[model samples]
Target: MAPRSRNASAPTKPLLKAPAQIGSLDAAALVGELRQLHEDAEDPDIERMPSDNELYGALLYAEKHAKALAMKQGTEAAQRSAAVKRVLLWEYLREQTDLHQAKAIEDARAVKAEWADLAPVLAVSTPNAAYNKAKRLQAARLIDTAHGDRRLRRTPEAVVEAERRIAAQALAERRAEEQARQRHQLVLPVAQRLLGHRDGLAFDTDAEDWLDEMAAVVDDCHTSTQQVSLARYLGATVRALARLERQTGKPPATTEAARLAYSAAVELLSR
Candidate 1:
């Protein structure tokens, strides 16, 4: 039998190899290597472009390697290096993707339009990468504004400041939450004491109103100033009621009950 013919349609071996030690390269060299790999992958004439999984693997490897290099440098230096890599990657995807130019531009515009929505999700992978990608996409969008007017692109400083603002906002939210939690803890016992006093007073008509007011005050205890106001008002009201009871003389069966309610209200105010 004749020898089997070679399969001319078979895929060729990859032109590039994974680096033995991607971590050995400095940030600049690693970025350059990535650009080269991306260019090779974007051969438009090929029926099938380079494997996306392989490209992603290479990117992940380079990122991890860059991070290792950054650990030895200061944090600021590492952040700058990561930013550079992310910007380069975004630029590569914009310019050298196998997609038609119009499709690529459309995709980029879509990303720009939804950047605010996309940022937090992207940040789950790498904060520096997400920030840099958002900045570059915004800059690209600014290049062509309405009426052929090109806006000034954001500076690196602006991007860094934006990131700082996001971080600061996150911190402020956390502090607010902690403060609210503390206020709730402080107000809960006072609210319970006030409810007990309502029970002891036994004013059928006023009990519902008092309970509603107490509920409103408890709801507003998220703020320290509001808590203080509620506490003072409740204390004053309780004291007035206690004075009235003393003047009128509580029934023997309810004298101790009135005293306990008055004592609780006093303690709630002191706290």
Candidate 2:
């Protein structure tokens, strides 16, 4: 028998995944699909396939089939089919488990989990055992083409590389947050003006919904993508309030503050 590489048969998830279920899926059919998924993972154009939940459900059914095979409850052909399904399912599960174990270890490290803390949880003898295990998993590089392992050891260089990747990912997230804060400056005055009059600022029934929505939308705008649409709302409010100022020539105090917010909004939009 040949020794299986930890990542050889593990497949990357498909791009567009649906809910995975085992409704009426039998062991025979699942075995065929298990082979197909392994093959499809090698194909660059594979855009769609069954997700992990489907395979997990199939493995549960295969377990039942395995019990029947043990009791000699099926015919020779049926027993052979069951045995093959069990083998394939076990192989798939083993590969998937290794990939996820590496990820879980990476996640544990993110929260400052030291090797000493991980040893007992990983069922390893000592902190060094845990460190060695992480190093081996880190070498696999499954996301890279499945040609060869990077063969990274638990040296300072290898640990630093992993830590660098983690830090870069965290920096990307912080950049996203920073960009959103800058974008929301476009409506920050509108939010503040409305908040200043936390009591309803609507001068009449017609302006009520727009005034309330302008404030709420700015408050809820946490992402850069959402800022553009919310700015349009603030712009419309400015036009409406400006018209109200022209018509009445003596608008209420809250309306006056909203008009001031319009000036701030104009400066932000010009930027």
Candidate 3:
């Protein structure tokens, strides 16, 4: 080492890149872009698969965005389904010791099962799951209270237990009612495209009919409905009509003609 080397070691470069370009991309932005790309690839027009590196990068980016979307959708769906479920539960509670109450509760239980099935797909995060689970647990407690068949009149012990149960039930009912009120106040417009409204008339009933068909699909996939066999069914109809309306494409003879086609297809499947 008689003469020290001019460049004994390579010049050290900053390990991190400059913050300017990266500033626009917070973690959430990166994830959302990746998801959009992934969803875009599902289109029929996309012929070739993206490279493995691209796919991997997209997946890594998507993780952060997952909880926000999943939880929001899950929560909204849960609240909507719960609105119907709770109403049914209330009716059942009032009719306890009556056979119809049992039947109605069974129906609500089925709806609740669907709510459970869908929640995981839509939940924003684990905390969303916890919240819904707690709500369900509270509802269960109320049902149990209304149906608790302990002979309170026969013994002091039974009487005390029944009173305690009543107190707990009262508290739960209040909480559930409050939740329902909060949810009730939040009225979101249903997707206009999904409802089949032209220039805005009351398409809510039509949408409900369509949704009922969707619910049936969840209830029984083996059976197809003219009404709504699959979630994709409505999506397909909407897309087809849009294509028909394209300037270069042939349009349906009339709006009535398009309606007939949609209605006929749904009715045939529903049967």
Candidate 4:
């Protein structure tokens, strides 16, 4: 048979095998496998190399799993921090009132309610602001008591100098308080105007127009302190409007009023 032609023989078919369970592998093992797959893919003689698409998919899944684990860890950490803060707050309340746990907790709730009530007056909008103010007030109390009767035995000149310093600090504090009060007064009329719009009591003036005018006035405030005060007042006003909305169940009016107030605050602060 003309020495059976070698080229006429049937070609052998390569055996197909199932892919490895990459998803079942741990991260390190998956990475190692991927590295080997990469090396195999780079080699010109290697057949049956892992597909680049499959390796990429495994890498993406691994990265996603790692991110999810990190997020879970972050959430746990935040929860722990919040729990610690609560414990510290409760302890502080107990020391202040010398109350047992039950009473202290009850008193703490009452204090929180009082803070809510004064939020509008003090222009304390956020929980963090209230917490910081509480800490500052505590520190001030400690400082005031630190000198106590120790200043009674100084020489005449020293006593006079100390008196002058005390007077100066007092004057500065009073001036700051007065300035804040004046800024608050400037905002009160705007808040009242908005409230009138909410209640349909403002004559012929649209709520939005009044809000714009108030914003213009805030923009005109030259000092940083004045701008900050206006922003804080607006934030408090928005919170009050929100509270009123909840009480009245008039979502449209209350929601719009809050939106305008918040926008005004944001505008002033951004400048």
**Native-referenced Cα lDDT, model 1:** 0.49
Q: What number of clashing residue pairs does each candidate have, in the order they appear?
A: 0, 0, 12, 0
In order, candidate lDDTs are 0.49, 0.56, 0.39, 0.43
Worst 10 residues of 3 by lDDT: 14-23
Off by over 4 Å in 3: 1-150, 188-271
Q: Which lDDT value does model 3 have at 135?
A: 42
| TM-scores for all predictions | 0.31, 0.42, 0.21, 0.27
Query: Could you give the candidate ranking by lDDT, starting with the highest?
Result: 2, 1, 4, 3
lDDT per residue for candidate 4 within 186-267, as digits (tens), equals 5655554554455432212333444454455564565646555554655654555445556656543435664564455435
Q: Which is the leading candidate under TM-score? A: 2
Clashing pairs in 2: none
Which candidate number would show the highest lDDT if scored against the true structure? 2
**lDDT by residue (tens digit), candidate 3, 1-271:** 5976584332121112221111112333433443444344342322232333453343433332333333433344433443443344334433332334334434655676454544454343464463344343333223223334311122223334445677887899777666544432221111222243332222334444544454444334332222123535454444454444464355432456445544444443343
Residues 1-271, candidate 1: write the lDDT tens digits: 9999985431211113321212222434555555443344342322232333344444555454443343432455545655576666555554433224334434655676454444565453555555455554443333222213333234434334444555787799888767656755765676666566554563433434545666677655656666555655565565555555566676212446655755666675566
In candidate 4, which residue ranges exceed 4 Å CA deviation? 1-146, 149-151, 200-237, 240-262, 265-271
Choose 3 or 4, whichever is better by TM-score. 4
